[model samples]
Target: MPVELTIHQPSEIFLNDAAVKVKAESPAGCFTLLPRHIDMATALVPGILSYETPEGREVFVALIGGILVKQGNSVTVATQMAVEGPLGDLKNAVDVMIREEDDRDRKTRAAVARLEADFVRRFMEFRKNA
Candidate 1:
């Protein structure tokens, strides 16, 4: 029996297919899952997830850190984000994802700093009026 692999993002399902075998990376190291693999769950690191389809075609997906669960012949990967394409294209996708995340983080930090400054200013003004 082949394993049913489903990759899900926050907004929608990324990929759903039958895979003969699947490979992913975790904190401990890289691991491969077979159809009959024991049920388990692991925290996946940012890396390439590769799987062999029933027709023997290899597919690649670039994923940020996430959780993977294998129960029976079903494997589910839930991540904040994932990009799927040929193996050669995965690297470029990962690079773009990292840059976008970094930009978002920078903007978030700037917003938080402004909010903190405004709160401090208001507190100081209230103290003077008392």
Candidate 2:
């Protein structure tokens, strides 16, 4: 019996496939799951998720931190982000995604800081006038 693997992201389903084996990284370390594996759940870290198809071909997906659950022959992964493709391509894609997220976060922080500074300045002016 093979295991059914499904990966979910907030916006879409990342992957749904039947896999002979699956490998993922967690806080404790990396682990592999096979059919009949014990039922458990773990906090997944940002890493590569690899699985073997029934035809014996291996596929890889880059995953951001998330939660993973294995129950019976079903494995479910809920992640914030994932990129799936050839291993080399997937690595590049993941790097780009990480950089983009970092840039967005930096911009958001800068905007918030500016807003805070403006609020403080306005408050000081009001206090002086009063």
Candidate 3:
């Protein structure tokens, strides 16, 4: 029997299909899930997630980060972001995504710092006025 695979993102369902095999990367390393695999759950890192369909065609998904659960003949993945495409394209996409995420983080930090500084300045002015 084929394993029912479902991938979910915060905004929408990324994929729902039947897979003969599923491969993903976790903190420990990469692993493949096959039929009759032991039930388990793991935290997935930002990497490529691939699965072989029953017809033996491979599909790839670029994942930012996620949680995966396998039970019986069902596997579910919940990720913050996911993009499905060819293996080569997905690899490059993941690299770009990482860089974009880092840039966003830096900008967010700077904005927070500016907000804190403004708040402190306002508080000091209020004390002086009082």
lDDT of every model, 2 decimals: 0.94, 0.91, 0.94
lDDT accuracy of residue 116 in candidate 2: 100
**What TM-score, to 2 decimals, does candidate 2 have?**
0.80
Residue-level lDDT of model 1, residues 9-123, one tens digit each, is 9999999999999999999999999998899999998879999999999999999879999999899999989998888888998888788878989999999999999999999
Return the TM-score for candidate 3, rounded to 2 decimals: 0.86
Model 3: weakest 10-residue lDDT segment is 96-105
Worst 10 residues of 2 by lDDT: 92-101
RMSD of 3: 1.8
Tens digits of per-residue lDDT, candidate 2, 3-69, equal 9999999999889999999999999999999988899999987778999999999999998779999
Candidates 1 and 2, the one with greater lDDT: 1
Q: Where does model 1 exceed 4 Å of error?
A: none
Instruction: Please name the candidate that would achieve the greatest TM-score relative to the true structure.
Output: 1
Pairs with backbone N, CA or C atoms under 3 Å apart (clashes), candidate 2:
none
Instruction: Indicate whether candidate 2 or candidate 3 has the larger TM-score.
Output: 3
Residue-wise C-alpha lDDT for candidate 3, range 2-29, written one tens digit per residue? 9999999998888999999999999999
Provide TM-scores for the models.
0.88, 0.80, 0.86
Model 3 bad stretches (over 4 Å) = none
Residue-pair clashes per candidate, as listed? Answer: 0, 0, 0
Give me candidate 1's TM-score against the actual structure.
Answer: 0.88
